[model samples]
Target: MTHGTSQSTSQSPAPTAPGAGAPSGRRPRRNKVPEVTLYFWIIKVLCTTVGETAADLLNEKAGLGLTGVSLLMSALLAVVLVVQFRTGAYRAGVYWTAVALISVVGTLISDNLTDNMGVPLETSTTVFAVVLAVVFTVWYRRERTLSIHHIDTTGREAFYWLAVLFTFALGTAAGDLVSERMDLGYWLSAVLFALAIAAVALAHRTLGLDAVGSFWIAYILTRPLGASIGDYLSQPTGDGGVGLGTVVTSALFLTVILGLVVYLAVTRKDVAPAQEAVRHAD
Candidate 1:
């Protein structure tokens, strides 16, 4: 799904990092993002689950309220992103670390709005959805493509991360809203999202859904799906979870993510073919 040049056909070889276009004889770096694969989705959902539980863990255990946890995670996310942007090519450790941190920050953002600022989940969900839409609109208008395969430029990377952040925030809010209104509890909510993602995949394969659209849709759905799974595992039995607690849930998912990242790093299977580079506007 990520290999085609369906989004843009006129890409040229570009410097891998910002301001690295000097007349050096060295070869340009490869893409900074991972190629979409089964590993990518697995790690993504795991990170999303970690995001859900890790945020709660910090808020409850660190004595940092929602606001404090948000600030702390956001600072860490900023630091990791700086390091990520400075790296010229995809590094599994750096890239996945940033993703995990961002997931926590994203969940915290939604929580603060709901628990701290008294904003309703519906309003936060709507606001985040609109913000995400604006980000995509501006990104496409400026870059002319939304394909992750082409995120070699700093500008595109910025837009991509911004969209990712909002997607998490939106997903958190929407998940809470749906679970509460429908009274489906955590396991059932997880099942609902799982089925939704399956339907999206089916549509993409058989009903002519475009790759980018299918990807983003699945991406957004995974956040809530992961959140539901986390909640189901972590919350008390009376609360419809298995009572594993946030600490266990977070640690469990993080371990899986670490193992997957290590495997991907060693195998290098998620790196795209250098010849199938991202197509960017001139």
Candidate 2:
């Protein structure tokens, strides 16, 4: 979404104003993120799912302990981030690869906190939430806009990745907290988060919520929703999950992510246009 005053979606009409976060008619030097669209959301959720199961698969099936898996994935993430930054613009392959790796790394961070350090999931959730809030506050204060539409500057891109990393960690902690602590089972947790996302969509579409606010809230919410889904499919039924196993679940989602990435790369359908000056309500 653009960084500007919002127009209302409810009722007849509301006075609309342009967002200053992204200057109108001023093209970004290099668009580092995809346009916010259905494709973006779909791939984001899939990446979250992979974040959960792939972490499990690597830690367990791949015979890498938590520390080993964490280190390995983190190194890979660093390498990809370097490549992503070097390319300069948003290449679908580079961008999505970084996202997928970051997802894994995010999951590992939460796991390290909760499992290795004996921190409670609830505590971790609260901690990550606070950390994410601080990051956003600082980012917005510095940039004057938290909108992803114009992530062209190095500082903005840096803030963007930092925020994304926190979101994944926060999502993992919260999802596990709800499913394990609250005894809500992975399936029920997925449904709950899904409904919450739907509510956010409705609020934005019909209740005149700000476009940027709605987008970020939904983006944060989807992480837990997708993680719950991944856990439900991969965990054992005896443990309140469907028992597809981590290997299978990871493979399935990875395949879908790969296909979608290829489609976006070949078609460039999700690329941000040079003139993305306005963001409208659905």
Candidate 3:
């Protein structure tokens, strides 16, 4: 997917001293989000790559053109999101499907603005970044927290998904901007974003940065990283890519995503326990 990301563990929830969204003595809510594990990142990257190449495949091979592809994918994304919202807790297959679809939709949104509407990549990138910042500001002011571990309520999940959508759009625009401006080949662009994410991880672990902030930053960074990887592998050799073609790249990544989703569904490795303690500590 063009844009997506999140964290490792969660703080347990509170026992309801101060009233919030729900009342006290309510049944424990399950964490809607998954654990921030290695598997999570791997699948996430696969999703981003799939989003990129798959969108290209549909647009070019399917002959739907950009507008048709955008509308079709957006409709499919809306349907998947509905199912995702209906789920009581994290289900790898459902969640990743939503993510992969959202990635495609997000990319399409940006592509439409740039390719169809004649907007510059720089303008779209800046616009999406500002919109994402405003969303984060509002989400934090209302919920007083941005941690993925505590997203048990519909409101929180809504904010989370909204953020994910913007990240994808922004990543697509910004990734294209950087790659084209610097004249850096896809491989170099990938390396650059990978290093940037590593710096975020290092900052969070060693430089006293907030975990939630670091996680979100890294999450957004991964979008561009994955996009670069997709372009590198899918574009022609003359265009400085590995020449795998969009279909091959999309299918390969999709297959990997499918395998991971099945593995997670069976093992439940990504599911984090709902923690009442985490809420209280905060």
Candidate 4:
């Protein structure tokens, strides 16, 4: 499951290059995001899986159809984002909570487009891809970098989360389109995306792909990979799933996410070096 070392920049933007200290007087800011670690990717994929299954659980069992479930998750996501923004540094609990909520909201967004509004997955996928590109274009234009390491400022943090949201939405649409069009079952779809992620890693290692580029590409691919896994576990067997049901799948993944977040909080192993610099500086 592990790919590279703790210092692998291929997983994320290279953390503040060695000894690149802050200027004369101003205090250094801690990055809002965690350092890319084995734990980071593990928890990220789990969160995406929970996002898919939990949304379905709510839609089917909570008596809240697509629209109702969408509104409920969206409101909760807004509240979590507010709390996340107000925090001074990367709080593992709050940060991961916000991510998990945003994942559900992203799934809902894509589901609403496809199931409620009768939009085609093809159209939604293309639209979300374009929107994500625009977000990145504006984010880079304004901040001069798309690297997560510099997400210490409110503006950069905003851009980061916005991009994350679109990635999940895009992944959902793209995953569904591919699975249906290619007649691939949930398991096969997961494998396909997993292979794509592997290729991206290979490109980064051998072909000299940019760190940020490789990270974001893998990040987007994880969404669909996780979603396909979620579907495979939760859907009925006749529907090409194991029939474990969404409740079981969501609970399983959420429990794993909670445990991993707690571990990261306690160990602080995933804290970015830049954030550590800020801490030591303070």
Most accurate candidate by lDDT: 4
lDDT, candidate 2, 111-178, per-residue tens: 99988999998899999999999999988776666777656667778888999999899988888887
Per-model root-mean-square deviation over C-alphas:
5.0, 5.8, 4.8, 3.9
How well is each residue in 1-282 modelled by candidate 3, as lDDT tens digits?
111223323332322445653421223356667788898889988888888888889989878899999999999999998898887677788899999999999888998999899999989999999999999998877666777776767777888899999999998899989988998899999999999998887776677567777877877888889999999999999999999999889989999999999998887877654442443444
The 10 consecutive residues of candidate 1 with the worst lDDT sum are: 4-13
Error of 4 at 73 (Å): 0.6
Rate residue 51 of model 1 by lDDT: 96
TM, every model: 0.89, 0.86, 0.90, 0.90
Candidates 3 and 4 compared by lDDT, better number: 4
* Per-residue error (Å), model 1, residue 242: 0.7
Predictions in order: lDDT: 0.84, 0.80, 0.82, 0.85
Model 3 residue 66 CA deviation in Å: 0.7
If both were scored by lDDT, which would come out higher, candidate 1 or candidate 3?
1
What does the lDDT read for residue 172 in candidate 4?
86
Residue 222 local lDDT, model 4: 94
Query: Candidate 1's residue-wise lDDT over 87-197, tens digit each?
Result: 777889999999999999999999899988999998999999999999999887766667777676677788889999998999999999999899998999999999998
Write model 4 residue lDDT over 1-282, tens digit each, in one string.
133333243444423443443211222367788888888899999999998999989998989889998999999999999998888889999999999998999999999999989999999999999999999998876666787766776777888999999999998899889988998899999999999999988887788777677888899999999999999999999999999999999999999999999999998998966577768788
